[model samples]
Target: MLRRITLISASIALGCLATIGPVLTSLYFANRDVENRDRADIQEFADKAMLRAELVTYQAFAALSDLEQQPGAACSPANLEQAARVIYNYRYVQDAGAYAEGKYLCSPLLGDVHDKDLTLPPPDYRTNDGFLIWFRQKSPLSDVRKDLQIGRNGHYVSMDPEAYVDLIDPARRPIAAIQTTTGTVFAVSAGADPNEMFNAWKHAGDVKSDEWNYAVARSSTRHIAVVVKSPRSSVVGDRPKLLAAWLSVGVIAGALLGWLAYRRVTRQLSFASTLEWAISRRKLDVVFQPIVRLADNECAGVEALVRWTLHEQAISPEVFVRVAEESHLIQPLTDLVLDKTIAQLGRLLAANPAFYVSINVSSEDLRTFRFLNLLTKSLQGTGIAPRQMRIEATERSFMNADATRGVIAAFRAAGHPIYIDDFGTGYSSLSYLQTFEIDVLKIDKSFVDTIAQDTASSVVAPHIIGMAHELGLEIVAEGVESEFQAQWLRTKGVQYAQGWYYAKAMSAGDLARWLGKNRAARTPDSIGGGIATGSIET
Candidate 1:
């Protein structure tokens, strides 16, 4: 009775421990989502503020231009009328006037004030394009004081500083400012000093203070920066609700975890047994996807992909392979693939000396010489050279540098070329590549899918290609679905590619017939037919 109680207590404790992981994971992702949304909102606000500032500045300059082209004396009636017209047309402009010799000569408000000696103060700032800016200037002839002034070529315009950020609703408005790239504050909303906001922006492009979240946007062409900040309460306001919800989730998850653990154990056991039986019965199959030369569309080689079926349902290789790895059955699974590959295409490979078949292997296979032994044993009487059976290991396989290096060296020494599969997806580094003497780098399909699209991953392919070229490693782009992608890869010096644009994975007979048809036709568009399903010898 005591031992049973102890075992139950331990199981409950373990269940709680496992439950913490999912609960914390859920909370972490929720927090991240909120933070991301906050960031996007502030960035958008800053951008809109910058654009508004730009439009205000452009209108000010345009008003000055119109006032300058009044077609008469600087303080004439026509000039006053033009100033009035500009002030009426431009919503941001508070006053328009004519200036000369650093003095306001006249305005529609203070008509013909040439003799009043309204001397303008020196400009607070000057833009690179010869426009003078005054941050705060007292009105010479009106009660309105401290309006922003911009002057160029004997014409000037005064604008309300608040107009730069007046587009947003007052209730939801954030503290914002328009400043120069050098942090000169010109216009700002209420609730904070512009200098403090600029200082925060200078310290970090985006920052979280005790009470606020701050962000910045900049225009290189206009040389202006917009700084905006919202209250931190807006982002963390739902913490109480989140805590309540996630606590409930944690309790439910704790209860479900035990059931899941039980199911997982049973499932793994059943899967292991089923896989062992399937391997013994030779029930697994191999399909070949042709890797063609991008320069001429000629069939260069094929990558052997393993497939499995259970109860008339196709099982993904990723699923079964992972179970095999966990069950310590990867070696037998690999042996089956190699045996079947040789059985199906052994004669074709032996006949076509230039042809090769790339086989995927796990990192465990590279930890020792057992895989090499298996390869040699499998090809002993097949009349296929060791080079014809190329070895492809994922980037993850190189994590054990010392072990993988020796095994890779052994594979290379045995006349088989070593390929780093899914080059950019995992454990990728220039130093890692330099450490391993690899022959080929296969670009993963994810990166290839981004080709010709405006996305972050689109540039990754070119960088990968360039890295491969600098290292003198051959490149093979996977998932090449469009001719545009093919042409793009061709221009980047990628030698090989494979995807639906050419042909999908097919059986041994289909690959043979596909190769034979391409050989006969010998044209770039010969493989345009969708998937190969017929048979003919090469």
Candidate 2:
């Protein structure tokens, strides 16, 4: 159960990691792409605004220069007519005239305005090229309140201040300004304060506020700076659509990767690995099936069987035992069985010297002396005699007689009786059985099940019994599930048997209670099916 839970947790953690990786990658690149596009748009707007400011300044200077070359007195008729032509030719110039002693002398729309009170205020700024500029000065001629004035060479041009920022679309509500590099504002749009925008651009070439994204551009050839800004919402439009598309792809890929990871790890924890884990942790259980003396139908000994339960599911011994042998885990598995059998039944066997428990071992265990050494150590201080723990091996374990002969002899030398379990089911013949000095032969359950049945296999059991008798071997009939089979085996001189005819295999505590009940009722009539016919009294 714990192993199952751990496997599930590890798989989920890996799945979450796989999922988060692609989503984060998509988000990072998406945000970066959007920011880059917005920055590019803002930069283009700033560049266009700078070009407009430069063009307006260039046209003002050009008109002033043309008016200065009129070839007569500053306010003469020819010069005044020339001023009309200058105003007509220059698109941004509203007025062209002569100025001296800080007062307008004459021209064009207001001809000879010397008596018109056209005195100019102090110039707002002076350029490096000896030009004077007045930003948004009130016009004396009419209610036109904001005009830009520039003077050079005793001539001046007056222009509308709105021309510097007129390119902006009013519906978009963008903020724009044109100013000198020294922070003199020429013109500005309505939404944002000119001084604040200039200060933001001065400290940072471009800046982002909660509501806006700003960009700045400066003209190297003129004392001009342009600042432009757009709303943050406009720059991030359509971003939700992009996020949805990328997120869908990420979820699909993450789910695929996560599923593959889960399968790969689950496959790694197969039955072989699980069985190995159980043996190492000592989680396997040992149960004892009582072997009865056929003559008196009394319990004589037992056979130790190993069982396993995984995740509330019982794993069959036949399946897991084969898996262990094939995967080379049989030796450790046999060691665990031996250790548990001794630990659970050691005291019981010590008290009853006539009782012995048969333990099964694999072919690999008999191929070396390691198992013999382990057996010696397991019984050293347990007060359990070697004869009380009989060693049982299947016929397949005797395949290599030369390799196993020494180990078998060592076990017998240590006072352990050896029994060959599931006999007549493998390659051992009567002549082959003569090769090892084995004590007992356990007839296979298949032959025992065939007793009294009208089948050809029923005759095979008699031949196996006759063969064991000729070889001077004790016979223990296996899987005798009925009184008829038990009576037949006892009539054929089988001395011992183990099957569900008496009781099923059980735990140590249950077996103890069973033995107590059987001992208290020793009469022949107390046995199951009232003792088989032709049975002898013990």
Candidate 3:
């Protein structure tokens, strides 16, 4: 009877372990999936918002084009006024105005006028004194009448919380300001707040939130308008909610299965803990992908991509990074990558002095002064010229305004060339371009993926290269996967290119021979300097 009681108790304990193990594991993986999905959803929303805003702008562009036709029934003050009203009255327009000479064509109070008043600085960045874009009367100084301007295309600026509230406080009145690109401007308080205005503009897919942060922008007219909306509650529960919900259900179904294997799972969990502990010992390394110039088919440099492996099993960088970040291991990993890449570059310089390395940085790394200081000290110790080492700063680099600027300044003072990586992937690409002292712009692969297609990329790539050149910056066309893609980029005056066309992420041992072989092939009529070893990594 005592032996029977012992067996029964042991069975219950085993059953409990069996029930919980799969449930917990399921919950963990499900949570990861959900978090990844949320990120994907956010990215999709940003992309859609951009496309929709551009479409709205094009409506204004059509108006501008019609007005320019002039005198042949294509242009009229009434039609111009109609287009102006369509844009001004539209929620997405934020503000729209027509400019024939200099003046307040759309100001509800200022009516219409052409005048120059340079004595006071423009109001609200549109006119002087940060008040009314126009004066009560004209002076010779304000010659901004003829300077018709439109907001930059694809600008995603948000105004008042039009989509959030259904009503507004009578105390917090809404106002609309107007301005011309040439500096003419005016303003007027709205008859109804944006909450009232938003009611009429409702569409098929509007969502709501309590608090949202916004980036403001303007149209051709200085009138305030809504362009894009971001949901910034930044939910922490999102990381695990889906997993938890699913695991709760999965556990009920797996009771028998769990009972059968309860002992094995406890053992595995203990093993996982030990394995994780071993991973924490700071034994990580980095590998790099050579970024080759498309024009001559020779290596321009290499981009450092990170890797992690232990006990013959390699962990996913994505998962490792997420967990590592949670536990404050990112700094150590970042340092390891930087040191290894720098060391590799130093060795490569032994045979080839011109080769360089582009290292990726995380938003966390940018926030810490210690990491930046360590970087500076490391580079200085290596004796590599600052220009030879390019720091590939992504949109993530500037998450904190003050710290990011401080970090950039430190590196810049040290003579390091800062390259903006994945330039078009973020919503703030143009804004970043205007604000940062960027020396090179690496076009994101998604945009470059369609270069061979007879689509927007064929036209857009050249325009980007031209624009970068105008800004005195070099363009690096990433993801050049085909000979046609390579040929198209070269024709468009893009000098540097990098992608699978050359090599994959590799060790310094194989890269040496690969670089030497490709370097030699670029000389004198060697298949028009084509990378004959297509898809070859030594």
lDDT of 1 by residue, 279-318 (tens): 6567998999999998778887899998999999999888
lDDT tens string, model 3, 462-490?
66788898888988888878888788888
What lDDT does the true structure give each of the candidates? 0.80, 0.79, 0.54
| Poorly placed runs, candidate 2 (over 4 Å) | 1-269, 524-538
Name the lDDT of candidate 1: 0.80
- TM-score for each model: 0.50, 0.50, 0.46
lDDT of 2 by residue, 1-538 (tens): 9999999999998899799978888777777776777678677667667666766776787677667656888898999988897888677999888888878898688878888778888888887888888887777677857788988878889998778777745445345455554576667777767777777668655554666678887776577777777765432367676466567878768777987996786454356656765775678999989999988878888899999999999989999999888866687788888888888787787666677899998888777655666787789987778898898999988888888998898888988899999988887676558778899999999999988789988888899899889889999999989998898899999999999998789988778877877765787555544212121111
Order of candidates by lDDT, top first? 1, 2, 3
